[model samples]
Target: MSSLRSSELDGDSDDSQLAAKFWEVKLPDVVPLDDLKAIEKTQAAEVIQRAWFSHMDKIIFQLLKHTICAAENCVTHEILKKVCPSEAALVKDPSVQCKVRFRFGGKNFPPFIVFKIFLHTGGHGNKYFSGKNTLRPSSEAVVDACKLMGNRKYYDQIIQDQLQFQKYKVADEVDVVTMKDYMHFTSFLDETPAYLGGKSNCWRRLSLENFPKTMIMYDIMDYATSGTLSDRLQKELKYLLQKPKSKEMHHDQLRIVSQVRHWG
Candidate 1:
C-alpha cells in the first residue's frame, strides 16, 4: 500500500510540471510600448474632438436663440442675407420683416467657418455681444441660419434644443437647492409651529430675518441634549458659534442626560 501511495505522489508532481509548461507556452503576446502609446494618443484625440464639438454646438444654439425672430415674417432677413446669402434666398417671405429659425451642424458648414465666426463675432468668453459688434454673425451662426431657411422642418429641432438648454438650467438650480437653500428649508421645517396640526404652512411663515439666531439656538440645544447632527449641520453650527477663542466654545463640550433615583 505504501509503494502505491509513493507512485501516486510522483504522478501528481508530473501533472503539476505539465500544467506549468502549458501555461508558459500559451501566454498572451505582449504589445509593444510604442503601439500602446499610439493607441492611447488616438483615443485621447477622439475624446478632445468630441468635447470641442459639443461646446461649439452649445455656442451655436445660443447664437441662434438670440438672433432668430421666431415670427412668421423674417424680420432679420437683412442680417441673415449678409451672414448666409444662400440660406437668405430660401426664406419663405423676404418682403416682410419677421422671425427666421436656423438649423446647424453636419455637412451644412464649411471647414474652419465656425472658428472664424467665433473669433471675429466675439463668441468667445460667452460674450456674444461685445461693445458695438453686438449683431455680428459668426460662420457657425451663418451655417445655422442657412439650415433654418433651407429646411422648414428644422423648427422642431430648434425647439428641442431650447428644451435641452432649459433642462440643464433646471438641473443647475436643483444642485444649488441641495446646498444652503436646502439647509434653510430644513431649519424652517423643524422650528415652525404647526397650524391646525399640519406643518404645511410652516415654510410660508418662515422669517428670513430671524434665521441666523434660530439656527444658533437649535445647534446649542442639539449639542447639549446629545442629539445627532449631520456633518454639514455640525460644521455650520461651529461657524455660527465662532471658533475655539469664542465664549460659546464651552457649549460644545457640555452634555445633559436625565437619570431616575428610587427611594426604598
Candidate 2:
C-alpha cells in the first residue's frame, strides 16, 4: 500500500512541474510604445527609439544566451524539465568545414576528410535585463561568463574516447595543410540599460520638437539613399567583378579594395 501511494504522489508531482514549465516558457506581452503613450504630444521618432531598443534587447539576448548556457552550465539537463524552455533551444555552430576525397579499396577504408576549422563566441539572453525591480545590472553575469569563456580552452582532448580525427594525406605534390587562429579585441565601457543602452530622447523635452524617424530609416537603406559610401562601393564591386580581358573603365577598377565601406 505504501509503494502504491508513493507512485501516485510521484505522478501528481510530475504533473504539477509540467504545468509550471509550460507557463514559464510562454511569451510575455510585447510592448507597443505608441499604445503606451498618446501620439498627440510625442512624435513618432522618439516612440520608435523606445520600440527599437526594446526589440533589440530581445535579439541581443538570443545571440548571447547560448554562450552563457555553455560557459556557466547554469541550465542543467534536469532544469530543462522545469525552467523556461526558450532558454534551452539548441544553437547550431558552423565552425568546421569538411571536404572529402575518396580512396579505393575493393571493400575497405573510409575516404579522407579534410577539415578547415574556425572558432565562435556567442552572446547571452535578455535575462541581462532580468531583475529590473532588484536593480541588478541586467544579463551582466551571463555576459561576464561569456567573455570569460573566450579566455578558456574551447576544445577538450583532441582524441578523447567520444571524438577523434585522422590526418588527411594530401596528394604527393600538394603542399602541407597549416592551422592558424585569429582573434580581434573590443572594449566596451560602463553599465548598460535594459533598453537602448546609450540612446536618448533628450530632445523630447524641448518645445516644437519633431522627429522624422521613418524617413531616417528609409534614407539609411544601402546604395540608394546611403550617399557617398554608395559611390565607393559601386566602384569596388565593379573592379572586383571585372572580366579578365575587358579594358574599359580601368580607372574605376583600380581603386583599393580596402577603401570600400563594408557596412550596408
Could you report the Cα RMSD, in angstroms, for every candidate shown? 29.1, 29.1
- TM-score for each candidate, following the candidate numbering: 0.24, 0.14
lDDT of 2 by residue, 141-196 (tens): 64564466553422222122123112213211122343311110000101122232
Output the worst ten-in-a-row residue range by lDDT, candidate 2: 181-190
lDDT, candidates in the order shown? 0.38, 0.31
Candidate 2 all-Cα RMSD: 29.1
How does candidate 1 fare on TM-score? 0.24
Off by over 4 Å in 2: 1-42, 73-264
Colliding pairs, model 1: 73-98, 74-98, 74-99, 75-97, 75-98, 103-148
Worst 10 residues of 1 by lDDT: 110-119
lDDT score, residue 32, model 2? 80
Please give the TM-score that candidate 2 achieves against the real structure: 0.14
Candidate with best lDDT: 1
> Number of clashing pairs, model 2?
8
lDDT of 1 by residue, 1-264 (tens): 999999999999999999988888666789999999999999999999999977655533332322221211223234344455664565534453323433222354211111011112233332222211221346566466557666554455346435533654321123345566555543433332332111222212111121122222222323323444535445444333333464344333221001111212
Model 2 misses residue 264 by how many Å?
A: 20
